[model samples]
Target: MSVLPLVFTSGWASGINAYAVVLLLGVFGATGLADEVPESLQRTDVLVVAGLLFLCEAVADKIPYVDSAWDTVHTVVRPVAGAVVAALLAGTSGSLPELAAGAVGGSTALMSHLVKAGTRMAVNTSPEPFSNVGVSVAEDLGVAGVITLAVFHPVAAAVVAGSLLLLGMVILVFLASRIRRFLRRRAQRREERSLAGAGRHRPHG
Candidate 1:
């Protein structure tokens, strides 16, 4: 029962060809379908869900202050994605299974949303608004493109997604290190100024 709705929804959203391509590519890569195969393949319902998710996020980022507003909206959207993913994974087993999947999915999405929100907040703190805006747009496009492609070719999408995740992690680490260094330098400068002021205040002796 749970699985059926999930499958149906994903399929209806993805359409046949695009969805199949996304799933197959995500799982096996383009080469995975190179060999002998049926003339036509069916798409999975999950692909549609994924595509829509990507589209929503991308669109949200485009609007001026709306990007911030959209982030708030994702507070709800991400968890839903998680729940859907969980339900689909749990199979149509039972209520307990569905609930458990939803719980896990919701939690995962929440955590991811927090991290993303925090990162953006930190980026916004920077003096360069243009950099922040440009980076934000790039991220939105990249995420949207990957999700769209993944729905059409899951195997290939999987590979691209995995690579993207890895790259994001690396970039995050680098940003964190830079932030730390910047803070340290600022602290050191403050301390030096304080010490120099104290010395100047002393009577000539």
Candidate 2:
């Protein structure tokens, strides 16, 4: 089987949780669980760095505004990571050229990352933190599951990942207007609260 499918799947997964994909691929490759993964990715230094970043994401992703900030920082990081992962994967087999692999990985990661960031922005309009935590957990699990499946069933994993990416993009487009209105309403509410609070604090006759 061509390694392209697995590369695409991993790239898509990286958009959601790049660190998890990196950490898992490193551990799996090092442990001989995923033979097609590159040795370079399995190095001790790579694993440690990926692990630490994954841990940081695990915590930051659960918080409301913090998650957005984290996502912002990762806008460039995730796509680059995806491209790097793809290049490494291609190097393992020499089946695909590194530039082509990198292009596929980087573009897929950007698409999924945009969907993720947009969804998070809409979720942030809500004052509660639970939704953020819930979405973050789901993304983390999705990344783990897809990567695990890619180790043994790369084709199947790619199909599933592609379907998911399509569905997410469709949903995001469908709800774009709604999300915008929701955010506007939330901002207006916050302004009203601020005005009310100011009135309460003013000196009265």
Q: After superposition, how far is residue 143 of candidate 2 from its true place, in Å?
A: 0.5
Give per-residue lDDT, candidate 2, residue 132.
89
The superposed Cα distance between candidate 2 and the true structure at residue 106, in angstroms, equals 0.5
Off by over 4 Å in 2: 181-205
Q: Tell me the tens digit of each residue's lDDT in model 2 across 19-75.
A: 899889989989988898888889999899989999999999889767877888999
- Model 1: per-residue lDDT, tens digit, 40-134? 22234444564565556555554444454566666766556555544544443453376765665455445545445445544544655565567
Query: Where does candidate 2 have its weakest 10-residue lDDT segment?
Result: 177-186
The local distance difference test score of each candidate is 0.47, 0.89
lDDT for model 1, please.
0.47
